[model samples]
Target: MPHKDTQGRRDSTGGVGGPRPQEGSPRGGLTLSKPSQRRTGRGRAEEELTRLVSEARLLEGLSDSLRDMVMRAQAYLAELRTAGSTLENLAGQEGVEVLVPIGAGSLVKASIKDADKVIVSLGADVAVEVDVEKAKEIIGNRLAEAQKALQDYVARLREVERALSAYRERIRSLLEERGLAGGPEERSK
Candidate 1:
């Protein structure tokens, strides 16, 4: 049972008819575009903004992981470079005793039998014996491929950073529009 005027017009809104409603108020005294039964116009916008913030946080995590991966890749690259350099020096030190790693932080004192030859792994636990020169060439190939792959990962990391920046920019704009908070730069100060 809704209240009605003398002319049978429904009270303001929520009924069959009313005085056509005020220009600014279609549903009631306050004008609002209801996106769903559970949320209002601003509620919907706020929800969207929240979603954007969550996505930005996820991107931040991914960025951290990517940074970790890049650091590890660089470290591995350095190790490979050191190995290559070591091989060159090792060629001159035939019959020299060395600390051969036997896993688990343990080493076995062993003498070099053939400094001109080394074992190279080609992934999947597969390895082949080759001369020092051949091993250097193989290492060079691996280094080249790793460098290229690292570059691609770095590129993807940059893209993620850009996306995160854009998300932050959008969140900042929406917050400013609603007088909620300041942008990143403003918040820093």
Candidate 2:
């Protein structure tokens, strides 16, 4: 059974009160409840803003990484074209002596036994011998696949950037509404 005050109202702490004064406060002390509630609300808003800012930064970083990947893919495609041309030129020379690099700037003079056959890497440490035209076709197919993957990455990066921008705008509006839009230092109080 709960205790009752003189006015017949049940009191949890057995104290008669309208609004209880906090201990150690001045005479005619202020209530603790309203101020604590305000602080809780403000703290939650600040946390949300911080989270939004972090997400935006992550998205921006991802966009930059995707751009670098696209550039590297394009460079690889150019190298493949150069390699294909070199292979085509080699096909015309049958008994010509060539300097084949063994390792570390060392070269050995070698005669072309069958210049028409080219070794193509199929990934995973596996390579197969194929004709020049077939090697070109394989390189072309790989380039097309890389281009498609690059396009997909670019599209995802754009989406993340747009989402980040929207989140920033929302955070700005929230801060402005709370009268803390001046800067982070101003909002700390």
Candidate 3:
């Protein structure tokens, strides 16, 4: 229930009330004013701040997850490069012979088993090892870029959280120091 003063007006309940004369307004002046509607404003600001804080925490979690993905991508790229190098070396051994023409714009096929077939196109014949390594390098680079981008996002979210914290603190201090809702002693008794 809202308290009321002797004037039949709603007391200092610190919430919305209908239009009323401003305190100390001259009598018989026919002047009336409505109380400023700030409760909704304050509530909206608090909700926004809470949303920012939650988003910041989510970003932090995403950043951590990205770090793991980056490491795994790097490892996979290294493994692919190593395997490509080994294959190139074995293809150059005595058991490996160029059965077909080994030149640009040509197709070469090596028959290893009765049903196993390996088709080497012009590009593959010339740069099979390099292509594998290049692909791995590209994937690893992209993963690193993604990790850095996620970290940047997390940092931006943290800045927003810090700003919200400052705003909340400022509002709290203002309300406390001003004693807007009666003084501490008055409320206690």
Candidate 4:
């Protein structure tokens, strides 16, 4: 029996298990051993693991930033809610009146007399002129300022949502690369 060497060429007097068989010996009685397989790399796997860890750290930082934004948005909403409640309470308060200009050299002042009846000031000697249109303009400007603040709050909320989405995408890719992604069953759970 003859066996090939590492170079694929047959050598003399060396067979299976380091011993040569006798000439014309029973061929079926010999046993052949297979070559051992080489193990794969460790360095490349380590590098991938390191990259995954760095990505996780970045994801955590983004999540923290998103949380801060959520807190700020909550504070802004609370402020808006408080402002709305204050406006409602002020409207419901006493001593509130709607004054309007009437005909030539005349004015009308309407105030909530009790709960049901509204009282109007009569044209008498105490009649005073007030620029009601200017007053409305001032109130409208203040309301516009409040509206701008509310719009800014909403814009900040959208920014928070955008940053959170980016972090989620990065984490998903990292988990997929490591074969650690929760499959359908895990997701359902």
Worst 10 residues of 4 by lDDT: 32-41
Please write out the lDDT profile of model 3 over residues 60-89, one tens digit for every residue.
Answer: 566566566556656655654554454444
lDDT for 34 (candidate 2)? 75
The superposed Cα distance between candidate 2 and the true structure at residue 188, in angstroms, equals 16
Query: Model 4 over residues 1-104: C-alpha lDDT tens digits?
Result: 66776556564446743444543458645533332111112344445556656765665676566567556656655654554444344434456685546879
lDDT of each: 0.82, 0.79, 0.53, 0.53
lDDT of 2: 0.79
Q: Could you tell me which 10 consecutive residues in candidate 3 have the lowest summed lDDT?
A: 113-122
Q: List the candidate 3 regions with Cα displacement exceeding 4 Å.
A: 1-49, 94-189
Among the numbered candidates, top TM-score falls to 1
lDDT of 2 by residue, 1-189 (tens): 457655664555555545444555676665457777678678878889889888878887887897888788788878777776777688678899988889998999999888888899999999999998998888888878877887887788788778878988988887897886876788778
Query: Of models 1 and 4, which has the larger TM-score?
Result: 1
Output the better candidate (2/3) by lDDT.
2
TM-score for candidate 2: 0.62
Q: Which number leads on lDDT? A: 1
Q: Report clash pairs, candidate 3.
A: none
